[model samples]
Target: MMTAVAQDRLGGPDVLYLTRRERPAPGFGEVLVRVRAASVNPIDAKTRESGAFLGDPPFVLGWDVSGVVEATGPGVRLFRPGDEVYGMPLFPDEAGAYAEYVVAPARHLAPKPAGLTHVEAAALPLAALTARQALVDAARVRPGDRVLVHGAAGGVGHLAVQLAKALGAHVIGTARSAQHPALRDLGADELLDFTEVDVHGAVRDADVVLDTLGGPDAFRALDTLKDGGTLVSLPSPEDDGVIPTAAARGIRAGFMLVQPDPVGLHHLTELVDAGEVRPVVAAGFRLEEVALAHRFAEAGGVLGKTVLTVD
Candidate 1:
C-alpha cells in the first residue's frame, strides 16, 4: 500500500485528506512509476474548487509527474524497470500524481533529463506544455517575431517568455514592478509594469500575445494584435460578444485549452538537456502539506512553479 494526498469533496484545500490504497500495477503498454515529485498548477486549484473535471469524491489530483520506473508492463520498450521518467499524465480528470506511485502510458513519458533534479523535472510538464503549445504550436513564433505574454512571472508566463526567446522571438511581458527584473532575467526583452501601464496602450501589433490572465482582458487583447495577428487566451471572455469585434478588426482571437503532447514533452526534455529552458520553482512542499499548498495556490499570484515532493 502507498499513501496519497486525496480529496473526498469538492471544496477548498482543507478538503484534502490522506489515504492509503493498494499500489497499482501497470497494465499492457504502461509503467508503474515511484513518484518522487509533483508540481501544483492552477488547474489543480480550479478543479478542486469546481470539481468540474474530477470524478466523484475521493479523487487524486496533480498532473506533473517525475519519478523512476519501478515496474514495466508487457510491451513497454521505451523504459526499463528503475529508469527515471517524467511526464504530465492524463490530466484534468485523473493523474494520481500526488502519490508515491502512479501508472502511466509509456509513450507519454521520456527519459528524465539527467540535468534536472526530480523536483525540477516535476515542475515542467503541465506549465511547460502550456507554454510550449501556446508559443510554438498555437502562436507559431518565428525568428524576429514579437511576442507578448501576460502574467510574465507566473508559472506558464515565465516559461512562455523563455520559450519564445528560444524560438528567436522578441518577447515582452507584463507583471508587477517587483517582478520586472526577474522577467528580464527569464528572457523577457521588455517588461511592462501592469500595475501602472495599460496593457493595450503599451503593447501594440504583436505577432502573438499569450493572455495567461483570462476574463475581461480577453477583449482588451484583441486590440493589441495587428491584422491577422493572434490572441490566444486560456478562457474566451466575450464568447457572446467577441467574434464580431474580431471580424471588425481582422485580428483572430481564440482560446487554447492545453492538452497532452508527447512530442512536445520529448522536445522539452532536449531543451532541459541543452540548458536553454530550466525549471524555476518558487518553493516545494511534501505530499502531506498538499492542503496548505492548495490553499496557497488558491490565493494566487505565485512566481514560478510550486512543487510537492511525493517520495
Candidate 2:
C-alpha cells in the first residue's frame, strides 16, 4: 500500500485526509515513479473548493512531481528504472502527484537537472511551464519589449519575471514593496508597488502584460499595455471577458492553461543548468500534512511555492 492525500468532498483544506491504497502500476509507455516531492499550486486549492476540474471526491490534488522511476511498463523507451525525472503530467486531470507513488507517461517527463534537488525540480514544472507558454507562446515577447508581470512575487510571477528577462524583454513587475528586492534579484527592471500606487497609471505602454491575477484585475491590466500589446492572463482567460475587452481596445489577450511540455521542461533545465533561473520553495510539509500545505497556499501572499515531501 502507498500513502496519498485525498478528499471525499469539496470545500476547504479541512476536506483533505491521508489514506493508503495499492500502489499504481504503469501502463504501456508509462512509468511508475516513487515520488520524492510535489508542489502545491493555486489551482489545487481552487479546484478543491469548487470541484470544477476534478469532478468528484477520492481524487488526488497535485500535478507537479519530482521522483525516481521505479519501474517502466511495456513499450516504454523514454526512461528506465532508477532514472530521476520530473514533470507536470496529466494536468487538468489527476496524475496523483501528492502520493508516495504515481504513474506518468514517459513523454511528459524530462531528466532532472543535476543542479536542482527534488523539491526545487517539483516546484518548477507547473509554474515555469505556465510562465514559458504565456510569455513565449501566447505573448510572443521579444527583445527590448516592455513586459509587465502582475503578482510578480509568487511562484508563477517570480518565474515569469525571470523568464521575461531571459527572453531579453525589459521586465516590470507589480508586487508589494517588501517583495521588490526579491523581484529585483530575479532581474525585474522596474517594480510597481500595487499596494501604494495606481499600477495601471504607473506602468503605461507595456508591450506585454502577464496577468497571474484574473477577474477585474485582468481587465485592469489592459490599460497598462499599448494599443497593440498583448495581455496573457493565467487564470480564467475566457470567463473574464478579456477577449471582447482586447478587441475593443485593439489589443491581444487570452488565458493560458499550462500543459505538459517536455520540450519546455528541457529548456528550463538548460536555464537552470546555466544559472539563469531557480525555484524558490517558500515552505514545505510532509505528505501527511497536505491539508496544512493547502491551507498555507490558500492564505495567499506567499513568496513562492509550498511543497510536500514523501519518504
Instruction: Write the residue-wise lDDT of candidate 1 on 1-311 in tens digits.
Output: 99998887888888888899999999999999999999998878877777767756678888899999999999998999889999987766598898999999898788898999999999898899999998888878898988989988888888888898889999989888888877788789988988788988888889898988777787788777787787778743456466578667776677787777889999998887877788888888999999888776656566788999985
Best by TM-score, which number? 2
Residue-level lDDT tens digits of model 2 in 69-167: 999999998898999999999998888899999999998999999899999999999999999999988889999999999999888998999899998
Per-prediction TM-score, please? 0.96, 0.97
The models' CA-based lDDT, in order, is: 0.85, 0.90
Q: In model 2, where do residues sit more than 4 Å from their true spots?
A: 239-241
Window of ten residues with lowest summed lDDT in model 2: 234-243
Question: Candidate 1: minimum summed lDDT over ten consecutive residues — where?
Answer: 235-244
User: How much is 31 displaced in model 2, in angstroms?
Assistant: 0.9
Which numbered prediction scores highest in lDDT against the true structure?
A: 2
